[model samples]
Each structure stands twice: as structure tokens, then as C-alpha cells.
Target chain A: MKARVTITLKPGVLDPQGKAIEHALDNLGFSGVEAARAGKVIELDLADGTSDADIDAMCRKLLANTVIENYRIERL
Target chain B: MKARVTITLKPGVLDPQGKAIEHALDNLGFSGVEAARAGKVIELDLADGTSDADIDAMCRKLLANTVIENYRIERL
Candidate 1:
């Protein structure tokens, strides 16, 4: 089984990295880019029968920094 | 309008950062982990009525590295 976990900063959190990327894009002549926020994606290949609850636990425990990010898990 | 673009490495590409993170997780005693692939998420705040095709073009032109990554756009 495979799962994809996406971790994104919560709204109102400062994202200096994303801001830097946005500036880079503007310098590259990519216009009309209003704002940018960057996050992370983590893909996991796990044993079959890995429950959703277990995956959620994984996100809360290790995959996501709940202090500043939210995570969503998708099973494939 | 807003769009979220997720960029992930193509399968078979080496992901050293993900490997390092996996090792860190293991060191933290989070077990049952198999493999980890890391990627990026970019959120864009755009003008109202930004078309999906335009968003896709942005991904191709500036947001994603087509050589090693694939992107998906979601509107919110």
C-alpha cells in the first residue's frame, strides 16, 4: 500500500522560504504572482492493511509539525 | 482565487533528502516505515477567475521542474 502525506503551514504563519521563492519567480519575469506559500509532500509505501488511523498517527507523530502545519493523507 | 500546486519527483529519481528524513524518523523510534519520497507544495493567490489552463501553464513555466517532477493543481 502507498500513502501520500502533504504538510502545509497553517494560515497566518510566516513563510520566509516561500517569500524568497516568490521573489525569485518575479525576478525570472513570472508576473502576476500575488503570493506564495511553500509546503512539503511525503510519500510512503507501507505494508498492506495499514489503517487510516495509523497513518493519521504517523502524520501527527512524525510527518507533520502540528505547531505550524496541517497534514492530509491520501491512500493509493 | 487560489490554487495549490504540488510538485513531486518522478518515480525512480533518487531523493537524498527524503532518505535523510527517513533516517531521522527511525532514530526517533518511529518504526514500520518503509520508504519516503519528499516533494514540494506551492500555494498561489491569483486574480479572480484564473483559469485552470493558466495555472497549468504557470506550473510548467515556473513552478515545476519538468525534468524530474510532476505537478498537480487544485483550486480553492
Candidate 2:
């Protein structure tokens, strides 16, 4: 089985990288980009039948900070 | 309107970050993690009714390197 984790910064957190992208876009003549948030995606190839609980644990332990970030897991 | 761009390395591209994560998972006792690939997700808050073509152009010009990565766009 395959699993995907989408990790994003929580609301109210400052994202300098995202801000840079937004500014760059504006400079490149792409107008009307109100904001941008940069995040990460990790795709895992796992053994079949790996439980969702185990995946959730991985996220909590190592994949995300959990304090300033939020993560969502999808099984594929 | 909102849009998401998921950028992933092409299959043949080398991903040292992904490899490091895979090894770290193994060291942390996460078995069954056969492989891992790291990617990026950028969420954009754009003006309403921003044309898909404009989004695609932004991706091509700034968000993704088409020679080495593939990107998927989702409008929300």
C-alpha cells in the first residue's frame, strides 16, 4: 500500500518561505496572488495492511512538529 | 479562490531528503516502510475567478521545474 502525508503550517504561524514565493510571484507579473502557504508532502510505500493507527503515530512522532504544523494522512 | 500545487520529483531524480527520512524511520523502529519520496505543496489564495491557464502559467514559470519535477494543480 501507499500512503501520503500532507504537512502544513498552522494558522497564525509566520511562513517566511511562503512570503518569499508570494513576493516573487508578484514581481514576475502574476497579479492578484493574495497569499501563499508553503508545505510538504511525503509519499510512503509501505507494506500492505499497515494500519492507519501506525501511520498516525509516525506523523505524531517524526513527520510533523505538531505544535506549529498540522498534518493529514491519506491511504492510497 | 484557492489553489494547491503538488510538486514531485520525477521518478529518476535523486532525492537525498527522502532517503534520509527512510533511514531515520528504520532507525526509529518503523518497519514496513519500503520507500519514501519527499515533495512540496504550495497553497495559493488568489483573486476570484483566476483562470486555470493563469494558474498553469504560474506553475510553469515559478512554482515547479518541469525538467525535473511534475506538478499537479487542484482548485478549491
**TM per model?**
0.84, 0.98
Question: Per-residue lDDT of A34-57 in model 1, one digit per residue for the tens?
Answer: 899999999887777778887888
For residues B24-66, write the lDDT of model 1, one tens digit per residue. Answer: 7678665766888999999888777767877887788778999
Chain B TM-score (model 2 vs. true structure) = 0.97
Mind giving the per-residue lDDT tens digits that candidate 2 earns over A1-76?
Answer: 9999999999999999999999999999999899999999999999988899989988998999999999999988
On the 0 to 100 scale, the lDDT of residue A70 in model 2 is: 99
Show pairs that collide, candidate 1: none
Alpha-carbon lDDT of model 2: 0.95
Native-referenced DockQ of model 2: 0.91
Q: Please, what are the lDDT tens digits per residue for candidate 2 over residues B1-76? A: 9999999999999999999989988888889899999999999999998899999999999999999999999998
User: Which residue pairs does candidate 2 place in steric collision?
Assistant: none
